[model samples]
Target: MAVTRTLEADVLRRQDPELADILLGELDRQSTTLQLNAAENFTSPAVLAALGSALANKYAEGYPGARYHGGCEIVDVAERLAVERAKALFGAEHANVQAHSGSSAVLAAYAALLRPGDTVLALGLPYGGHLTHGSPANFSGRWFDFVPYGVDAETGLIDYEQMRLLARTHRPKAIVCGSIAYPRHIDYAAFREAADEVGAYLIADAAHPIGLVAGKAAPNPVPYADVVCATTHKVLRGPRGGMVLCGAELAGQVDRAVFPFTQGGAQMHTIAAKAVAFGEAAAPEFGGYVRQVVANARVLAAALAAEGLAVTTGGTDTHLLTADPAPLGVDGRTARARLAAAGMVLDCCALPHADARGLRLGTAAVTTQGMGEEEMPRIASLMAGVLRDQVEGKQVREKVRELVTAFPPYPG
Candidate 1:
């Protein structure tokens, strides 16, 4: 349990009736539901304990040995552990565990590599790119001159020729690779070559695939890119925080950017939790878990595709797959809401440069609950029934609830 448990109101107000009620409500929800969002996962209970520990009380203002404040001995140890574990997990020359989120990590990387108003080449927002990549409304776009790229019209894959053309034409200072929606494996070697041709830095945002990369199931870009940024919460199964890993040449700049430019005092408790998570990822069983994540995603995608739904990108090679529910005359929002009511959860996400009819589904959360191929068929069947609005959906939801109860996610 966390050392900060005493700080919770429950410990102080044992006589209050509302405390147990709220806890039981949340517990009941997790005890009888499924979570399928691609960018979301269920952290281990121990990870949660670490995240809520007493380390949160610390006021460490800088990196391990160089802090602005005094009494940072424990915080220094935690932060150093987080950095060391992150470096080992990703095979990076250096790691910074201070960024509050993936967006902050991206900002820090850009700040380290490029001046304000410098040009950057990245995928367009409508084409699976994140807001931080260069959305006009975001600081990245507002601060820099962003040249966006898109996938081919016919094939749902990025246009390398177009990217090369953009890099040549724009002379960008950096090229950002990775996406929230694109499904195939990225050609980091091609990106590395393109960046080199333009004398631009290569920044890989592997927030969606860090778990796969850590398990060595997905292609790693640490050796090929100047910097890589990712969230520790998503596939890494840690706290809701971010990390920046880079080559030794850029290490000091990355650290300063993450520390003084993007955030204030770091969350030392989360850093310690991130250390624990990285330790878990380094274990041999983590590779097996990541492989199962991919296998379960493939089975889910194929099952949905067999039912006439449009599985995006032909198929997925990672932990996520996108499916269009429009064939059954339903939109993504409606499908997601109905699925939630049925005790299954998925997020509605617009397809890359397509209409808002597709749903982004992942297996990480459910797979963490010890589910396997057995849940895929039922999940696909329930999705089909929900989209079709058949009476069978009610029956399917009952069975789904039963299965979820059997495998109780996030058990306390």
Candidate 2:
């Protein structure tokens, strides 16, 4: 679908001009800056429309047709559409779209499969593991016995041999395979084999790559993992929510876990928006969008490398990449601040095998803005100039504003 020129700001302003101004202010910020954040993207107006629809009023407390609350008939249809769309999109026998966020979906997966004291193996925090994987402060760590695994010290790749050894040594109840900053495609088949050897359940935390999977730009984990948990947003371009995919045998357990075990009422509005996004992703155009996202990311990673950043794994196969900027005379935290001052918005992530932070960025939002590989080198050059103190902050911000103005996310 074509991007729209206007939003429903008139109605919002009529009701509350104060809050409306805040909304427009955010729009201005987004329009004027570069969105290099890996975990962010622009949702189509159709998805946004569903989020602000009448479905928001509904408080559906359970699955479709089995709600705990009365008057859920209409919302039931919305949830059903979301579930079926997710199932079809991922080729999963069953899907639950009710989890409130990616972490909630992972919690449900653990609830459905493992006991409180069961041991689980996951990527370590320093190696790109999510907080839900095994952070000491998270519920996963407080409840389960989590064994951390690290990547290869030299290659920055998941040490499969080490993972297998850990799996066999610990005999964990579950093994998780995914990362927030690992830029390569995961070998789900290898993970499946490791899980099988130990009779452990394979849980794929595909929150970042699920969007690429939807567009067939990356491998899908649904076929190999016993359970797959992911967010509906990110490059999927849906509402901010979560989903779980599994085979039919685990459908009942997963659904029950998502509802009564982990969360209460489902967000019907977000479900409707996810349904819209899944439909969009199924279209042929979304495939092109995702492919371009990867292509642009590759260009950006290489250009950043040429500009003195130590690109992780040498480069990337997905939409996101992590790079060390020490050679540019700044660390990752300082580089992030400098980039922000130059109108480039991104995140600082953990650097595997190093104590210092690294910059993680992606091309998802820029691809949504219709940028291509041609623009990536320019972005890298500007970023390097800012980090090296070779250009004035005011001048860089002005150039960034000029570039984004030509490709407005919501062009008028």
Say which candidate scores most in TM-score: 2
Which digits, one per residue and each the tens of the lDDT, describe model 2 over residues 54-81? 9999888878888888999888888888
How accurate locally, in lDDT, is each candidate?
0.85, 0.93
TM per candidate comes to 0.94, 0.98
Those runs of model 1 whose alpha carbons end farther than 4 Å from true positions after fitting are 1-20, 392-396
| Location of the lowest summed lDDT over 10 successive residues in candidate 1 | 1-10
Candidate 1 residue lDDT tens string, 1-412: 2222333445534776576566666656766778888888878777977877898888888889899889999889888888888888899999998889999899999989999899999988877888888988999989999889888877778999999999999999999998988777899999999999999999999888888999888999899889998999877788888889999989999988987887899888888889999999999999999999989999998999987788887789999888888887888888888888887788776676676757888988888889999889888887788778884556767877888877767543
- For residue 385, give model 2's deviation from the true position in Å: 0.5
Distance from true location, Cα of 31 in model 2, Å: 0.8
lDDT score at residue 248, model 1, on the 0-100 scale? 91
Candidate 2: misplaced stretches above 4 Å?
Answer: 1-9
